[model samples]
Target: MTVAKLAAAPRTAVAPEPTGPVLSCAGLVKRFAQRTAVDGIGFQVDAGEIYGLLGPNGAGKTTTIKMVCGLLDADAGVVTIGGRPLAELSVRALVGYVPQDIALYPDLTARENLAFLGRLYGLRAGLLDERIAEALELTGLSDRDKDRVEAYSGGMKRRLNIAAGLLHHPKLLVLDEPTVGVDPQSRHAILERVQALGDSGMAVVYTTHYMEEADRVCDRVGIIDRGRLIAEGTKRQLVSRLGEKDRIDLVASGDLQALAASMRGVTGVESAAAAADRVHVVAADGRSVLPDLVEAAERSGATLTSVEVSEADLESVFLNLTGTALRE
Candidate 1:
């Protein structure tokens, strides 16, 4: 569901001058009970940029966004938008936050839903109607604007959720796992819209567990885990962090963790970690290490279906840094 963090705030009459990064935050930390949920995570998103917070679930993606949206105060550090502190009520209105869950009214038609939420942000008659039509078209729901939310498919509902987020035309949009369970086609549509938003100069913070999603839609990605940001860069730059290393993927069954452990003992392998259905290994020499890896897998009682070797990629970077897969 959308948090509507900005919906109730008083709107500012003038947009901030775009002279710097549209959103910037640093040294953000948050803790609950005895455990830290977000630890010293920081990044900046300029206008016309899509910055993805790449991480597995509970890696503090949601918690960090909450602080950024001013839904939760940071235990330390600060967040600024367009060079203005988030503590200012007027500045909060400049953020559009679309949460992972759906928040539309089931009985309302798509047009009605937009009209309702649009008014919550102080939109007026003519402008509200125009924004409703625009948001529906932007989300590819203009053809179904008269359809009730209850009758729409899962993907359609997800898209409408995004439309509701755009009514205010905020400078920055924070999307938390926006494509979690949609069909492939709808997911594709959503990604296209996100890319379009970036091209049109909206600073977006997108968070997801899917590595491919991060690779496809994000301009730069920040890999976060265990409440800390481990790495941040573009796809090519992040991959370069693995410098000259080759990655091997062994798709197999049975005791994958043991197989990974066995590979870790091999001379050439730099690292190994087991994930669902496979084990990932990095080495200086990919082809030459295959024989040793096969023997190790056999000794671990694992059955190999296929094996592949390639230069380092985003997956390789994650495996190298965390000793775990992206979906772990």
Candidate 2:
């Protein structure tokens, strides 16, 4: 497929006024029985920017989105849109939400579904019709507007879901795992559309478990785990958090823990741990630390068939800070 045009006509015909943040959540918390699902998480999305919430399963991403959209009341904290508290009914109209699951009627045609949703947002006859057409075209589903939801592919359904959210031209769009289970082609298309939306100056809050997706699409990412934010920054800034340390991986057949213990005492090596068949080591300088690791392995009576060392990446940073894999 061809790359979607990054440079397009500006979103608004009129000049945009300088403004404050379009969306903000501060000290947000949610609880279910005995567990805290969202624990005082906070972030802001500026107008015309994309902010991604990234984490593994059960990380409270969905809960956070629900609170922001006013679908669920926060146990504590506040959500604001365009400087107005979310408790105001007017703020709800300014925010559009696209959930992970498909929310359209399976029996309705694409255009019909959009028109129905548009009406709910208070769009009337001629205006609703026009908005429906624009949303369908923007999502690349204009040609399939007459198709029934059940007849559409997973990706097509996802596009239509997004289109439904855009029916009223919301100032802020909240998307939760929008590309889950989609084909690579569809995934790329969805990502392109999201970028286009942000380029048009709509603030977006996107949540996903895919690290690469967040890295590629977001201007900045907030990493959440166990209902709390462990880290947040641009990919470069997050990786730079591990600047003083380098990572070394070793592949071996026997006694990995024993080998890790030996490597931990080597000069320049800060820490070492073994998981499965590999030993992961953190050091001040990987190049200066490799020889000592090799000699230590040999002394521990373990055969090290291969070794690799490189600058720390986002995954390593996550592991170092949380003691858990980002994908887990």
Leading candidate by TM-score: 1
TM-score of each: 0.94, 0.82
Candidate 2 overall lDDT versus native: 0.83
Off by over 4 Å in 2: 1-18, 247-310
Question: How high a TM-score does candidate 1 get?
Answer: 0.94
lDDT of 2 by residue, 94-211 (tens): 8889999999999999999998887777788877787777888888888999989999999999999998987777778999999998999999999988887887778899999887
Each candidate's lDDT (Cα)? 0.88, 0.83
Clashing pairs in 1: 1-101
The prediction achieving the highest lDDT against the true structure is 1
